[model samples]
Target: MEKYHIKLTEEEAGLLSKIDLRSYHQNHEEGRAAYLNNQEPILALLKSLSGRRAVPEVRLSYWNDPNYRSGRIKGSRKGLFERNGCTGSDIYTHPHFLEQLRYFLFGTELPDAVIEAFEAKVGNPEWVSSSDIVPIGKAARDLTRRYRLDIAAAPEEFFKLCLDMGLGLSAAESVMRSVKQVR
Candidate 1:
């Protein structure tokens, strides 16, 4: 895969900083609200992109309705999504949007595996045992230092950057996989 050396402008960085990455990844509604609420920068950034053609309206839709089970809340959001015209292409994953988002957030186009690792490990306590916390954290710190990234101030970003930059699969695997006792 070709590597993109992405750098974020001060304004873009500030805009991304306002978003809570953890909530954006872990909780759908809260994250969507944050993005929707702080969409000026996002729209401006996309507009500035030379390769971008269509600028999507930043709004909420229910493509992945966590409340779609047989209950009162079921299809509640679906109707809203239909009314909002959010049923088309997922704007969040659109190439242009992702390109800008990745640049602002990770400073590079991280692989899908790395992104998955982040969603799996960070803020999910069951993935890593208490004993493994220190080691995993230390590993993340060391990896970030090696990459010369200044995101260590934020541990969440630090870990994601490190894992993507070449922290080896061990850190993610160690945290994500449970040890199976040999019979």
Candidate 2:
């Protein structure tokens, strides 16, 4: 496993500071892509800040219908997943995850156990599509609180930045696991 050091410039920091929350969410898809691509710099930022880890619960499409706002946050997996709507690839343990990990993290393929983790989550019924393994909003909030920065306030670029840096975290974790295996 190889380690890459990443940093962000003052200008880029300033650029992020000026972006508003509405605009960030409005461009969520593009923002998500950019967040995925330039992950290392954001990871660098997070490490310097030393943010907290928080698990967030997101509202899944089937779980939280607007008409049924009373039952928005569901605790059970029953009736949450639409059997008809689900495809083989849409499940969590699909091969696409390993392929993405290979492309982003290393020249070599991921270990079988890593792949198994994904497979373990597949069709579990409890698995929700709305939230990520890394809770972006809460992580951003943690960074802001610890660093005394206004990350969660507006233009919430901090949150988006956290989301963007998911790939970097994944790579770092993957490398660490691989190194442990070698030892």
Best by TM-score: 1
lDDT of 2 at 30: 73
> In model 2, which regions exceed 4 Å deviation?
1-129, 151-155, 159-163, 166-183
lDDT of 1: 0.41
lDDT of each: 0.41, 0.31
Against the true structure, candidate 1 reaches a TM-score of 0.28
Q: How would you encode candidate 1's per-residue C-alpha lDDT over 121-178 as one tens digit per residue?
A: 4545445445665555554444444454445223434333434444433443343222
How many angstroms is residue 40 displaced in model 2 relative to the true structure, after the best TM-score fit? 30
Q: Per-residue lDDT for 1-183 in model 2, tens only?
A: 222112334644553344221224346687665445444443433333223211111212112233212235543222333333434323222222322222222222323342333324322323423443333333323433444443223212221122222333232233222222211
Structural similarity to truth (TM-score) of each candidate: 0.28, 0.18
Candidate 1 residue spans exceeding 4 A from truth: 1-5, 23-29, 51-100, 103-183
TM-score for candidate 2, residues paired by index = 0.18
